[model samples]
Target: MPEKQRLTPTVYVSVDIEADGPIPGPYSMVSLGAVTAGWHDADGFRRADGKQGFYRELRPISEQWDPQALAVSGLDRTALLRDGTDPAAAMRAFTDWVERLRTGPDGRRYRPVMVGYPAPYDWLFLSWYLVRFTGGSPFGHSGCLDVKTLYAARAGVPLASVGKRSMARGLLPDLPHTHHALDDAREQAVLFANVWEWDGVSRSG
Candidate 1:
């Protein structure tokens, strides 16, 4: 008989970020949050039993920012400048958190996968800062999952038609969509877990 391939355990970490502009460098990721949403392997998937999260507000790296982008997050740039954590320190702390998650009690290492609602926006800022400040990213170059795209694929619909409003009610998380980084991260955690376990027909049909 042929040997069965062992599936690697993957830890899904839901992440959210509030930025002062559309991209990194010229802009800045002002606030960011991440939560261990769940883990999956050959056995099955399970959601986090309790909240395991990390959050940080960072000082702007550049003075240039879009006024509208700042308004969307409703964070005071002046206050962040004075009180926010340093970018290097913040990225280090975030990296440490991810490392902790990757180390298992049984000594088996798990892959840490980053999950975000839309993903690209958050990944752009996160990857840039991690590489810039920490010299590397814990998620590496490709350890990201987009919940929106997952839902779109599972539902067999065009990505553009997969907004919350267009999704099935059962697949939606009950959490509020607050712009606060931690709150949104927690919300996304639940949403990611829901989508991970979904086995449903396409709503488009």
Candidate 2:
């Protein structure tokens, strides 16, 4: 990559997870997904390639898997059994992949931020899961950016006003179906891009 093509400091890991309900510890994480992006992708705000990192899926802990949550995510125990990787292994792989992006090929540290639509909800489950599985988050629990809060703040409105339906109607080309973790994460990313474009976000430093 050329000097101008070098990656920026602002990297985003947009995440989503399906659960039994609002509560964190008691409820369980059913399915989790995340897409990585960078500040250059901020709605054509500047010159940047907006390169994509990668997506990850982790195996759920047997005790943490909930039947009701499976109903919501439509993912059966059989599927998880066959496809999921162990939680600790998954976290190690995920953090390793993340570190690669945050650092240069030669190994410089990068502190890419994490982003989520309804942040605290997803982060609560993820943080707990990471701590339980790995003892701590590699990102150090810093920079948990909330898209809903960003939308609310930019629109000068409350969260209720920026409801998914309203946001889909006003900004997105289509509404995202909830419960599907990967799809939801992608939809939130799209929504964020659209909002950034509309709001004319200039600098994301």
TM-score of each: 0.93, 0.73
Residue 86 error, candidate 2, Å:
0.8
Give the number of the best model, judged by lDDT. 1
lDDT of 2: 0.63
Off by over 4 Å in 1: 1-5, 105-107, 202-205
- The most accurate candidate by TM-score is 1
State each candidate's clash count: 0, 0
Quote model 2's TM-score: 0.73
**Native-to-model Cα distance after best TM-score fit, residue 14 in candidate 2, in Å:** 1.0
Q: In candidate 1, where is summed lDDT lowest over 10 consecutive residues?
A: 1-10
TM-score, prediction 1:
0.93
Poorest lDDT segment (10 consecutive residues) of candidate 2: 41-50
Q: What does candidate 2's lDDT look like per residue over 1-205, in tens digits? A: 3464464445566677876556555555666776664454222232122244344454555455556656877776676667866767766666676666675333444466677877888888878877877788866766688878777777667777777655534566364667677777776666666665665233221
